[model samples]
Target: MKKESRQKESLGRILKYMKKYWLFLGLSIALAVISVILTLYIPILTGDAIDYIVDKGKVDFTYITPILKKMVVVILITAAAQWIMNVCNNKMTYNIVRDIRKDAIRKIEILPLKYLDAHSYGEIVSRVIADVDQFADGLLMGFTQLFTGVVTIIGTLGFMLSVNVKITAVVVFLTPLSFVVAGFIAKKTFSMFKLQSETRGEQTALIDEMIGNQKIVQAFSHEDEALESFDEINERLEKYSLRALFFSSITNPSTRFINALVYAGVGVFGAVSAIHGGISVGQLSCFLSYANQYTKPFNEISGVVTELQNALACAARVFELIDEEAQVPDAEDAVVLEEVKGDVDLEHVYFSYEPGQKLIEDFNLHVNPGERVAIVGPTGCGKTTLINLLMRFYDVNSGTIRVSGVPVKDMTRSSLRSSYGMVLQETWLKEGTIRENICMGKPDATDEEMMEAAKASHAHNFIKRLPKGYDTVIAEDGGNLSQGQKQLLCIARVMLCLPPMLILDEATSSIDTRTEMKIQEAFGRMMKGRTSFIVAHRLSTIEEADIILVMKDGHIIEQGNHEELLQKNGFYAALYNSQFAQS
Candidate 1:
């Protein structure tokens, strides 16, 4: 029941977009009605033409020609009306899909980091592109079939009843048996299709992972293993897809068989009625035509039901993404933080990515405005998690993180995030000109301001060497640039932001020591008045920090300046000595 409700809800959301083009859709529906009405006349006219031929007992052109001409006119008008309706349907369907795609893109922008992390890039991409495309095609087919089918069925039945009620009753009784078969098969197929959609998502994710990490796969000599893994996922997808298609395919034939039974029954019953003078031969002919027309729509609907099932499955996947519980809603009265003073305080903070698996517990910290703090830790020691909390990427499970004396939770996310500039170890650069990537943090930045930022980050020289300098379009994710160069561009982005607070996560790890010193010197200048949190593995990088935090597990085991921590000869001392001790 819940699954059915969700499907209905997904359909409702799709129809909401259709409401925008209601005028066109209504016109399409109106045209379909007219076309079906005109079509229904053809059977009646055909029957009349048959009767006229019988009455003449010879080929009398005078009587037959008029009825034949009327038939031709009706056929032509119905064809024309159907053509117009199709044009309207295509326009409305395409436009609706376009709008749906736009919404999916926008939803990706607002989705939380956790959601992005949980789902594979391939899975998300599949939902946005492939699934949506399938949904659009299915919706279009389903709409056309549904509208025409229902109209024809109703109109055909009404005409049949008029010709002879008894024959129409036989159709009504048998037609429902077709529906029962269709409904049972449809019920069986729905679960299969849903499983297929999920398997497809997993398969897509596997493909993306393999393709993106092809180098690693080759380096590890895991080609056969990768193929085996992919084959496993592919096999599952194939299994479910085949099952869904098999069951769905049964619907049309089963329904058609039932329709054939109705046709045969109509033939026998109508012949007996006509022989007994209960109905004329003309009425019998009309009833046969109406029976075909009536059942024809049922067959079309049965076919469309399969398509609709697929569409609903795809749509369910899409809605699952769009309906993801949005980032815990910001406090209603969340205030904007302007001209941030950069004082940061973490009071007995507790956090965990997963419940009962606490990564940070009873964490407390305080920093005066404009202080430079270096956080050093072993891998998975909550170093980056601290930054995530400070930046409000993930809220602390308990306790408060305050910036400039205001709880981070009390501030709007945009305003809070805008107050801080961040540069991470893994640099991200979109497909755009070098200048645009640097200016992304401040889109309205002047060329001079941008160039100054590039120079400060020591990225100016290499950028100047590029064929188009700052105007050079970087390939997607800066694939055209070296790792160090990409890091430099990311630094330049943070430099351009000039936020009052900075979070540098292995900010210079990619750079050579010499270039690192140059950028560090520039960072020294930039850090003068800004509250800076530097996360680094290299002990050499944090020597100048005003405060050094040595973290182990989830707790701050030591806090002091580099010189003081050295004297303590504890965890920080062992950590610092180990790096140079090997050399």
Candidate 2:
């Protein structure tokens, strides 16, 4: 029952998308009606021409010629109407698909970061691209075949009833059987097709994961395991796909079998009626054509049912994505922060990715304006989680985080986040020229300003050596550039913006020591008057921080200037000594 409801809801939403193209839809329907009517009239003209032939010698060419000419004109008009109807259908189907894609992309943009963090990138891509393509195929088939099939069925039934009530009754009687068989098979196939779509998404995700990290798989000698996992997913996808197709394929043949019965019933009864002088031989010929036409739609409709099932399944998945809860909108009175003074405060904060995990609890911090604070902690100690909360990527479960003395929640997320310049360990660079990448945070930045930021981040030298200098177009995710170069570009991006506050989370992890030192100097200059939060594992890199925060298991174990913490010989001293000892 729930599955049926969901299918109806998905179909309803698709219709809503089509509502904007009602004029085109109406035109297509009108054309389909004209085409079917003209097509049905052709059989009558054919029967008339047949009656005109009497014993072959008494045939009247003048009368028969006009009927034949009328049939030709009807066929031509039918063909033209069908062609025009198809054009409208194609336009509407593609336009709806385009709108669906656009909505999916817009939803992705506003979706909470937590949602993205939980879902695999490849699965999302499949929903937006592969599933949508499948939906388009189904919609197009429905528009082209289903509409005409329905009109043909109704038109043929009316024509048959006018000629002979008994014959038309036989066709209607057998017609219900076709619907019964199709409905039974369709109910079974919907679940199979839904499973098939889900499994296909899993396979796509697995393949994407393996291909994107092939270097790691080879380095770890895990090719056999990767292939094994992929084979498992591939086999499941094949199983579901085959099962779905098998059930859907049954609908067509089963309906065809019932339709043949209807056709046979008409032939047997119409012949008897003619032998009894109840109808002329020409009328029997016309009735036979109407019977074939009436049953043909049943067969076509069954095929359409199969396609619509698959399309509905894909559409359900896409709508599920679009319907996901978006990030809470900024309050109506939310104020945009301007002229940020860089004072940050976190009071009694608590957060966890999952409930009952209690990752971070009662965390408190206060930074004076323009202070440089560094955070050092072991893995899984909520170091990165802290940055996530500060940037509003994930809201704290309890308590408040304030920037410049205003609660973060009270400020527009865009305005609050725009105040911070972040350079993280995992650098992300879109496929674009070096100049475009560096100027991403400030698209309209002057060339001199961009070059200065690049030189400050020690990326200018490398940029100048590139084949196209700053115009060098990198591959997606900066795949063509070395990790260090990508990191430098990310730093240059932050430098170009020069936000009032900074978050440097292992910002130089990818760079060599020499370049790291130069970047550190650049960072020192940039951090001079900005409130900066630095999260790093290397204790040596943050020794000059105005304050060093030692964290453990989501608690602030110690907090003081580097010298003060070193003198106290607490967790901070132990972490610092361990790093240098390892070196």
> Judged by lDDT, which candidate is best?
2
lDDT of 1 by residue, 34-135 (tens): 999899888788777777665544766788799989888888899998888888888998898888788888888878788898889999999988888888
Worst 10 residues of 2 by lDDT: 574-583
Error of 2 at 54 (Å): 2.7
Off by over 4 Å in 2: 56-59
Pairs that collide, model 1: none
Q: Per-residue CA lDDT of candidate 2, range 42-71, in tens?
A: 889888888888885889898999898888
* lDDT score at residue 188, model 2, on the 0-100 scale: 92
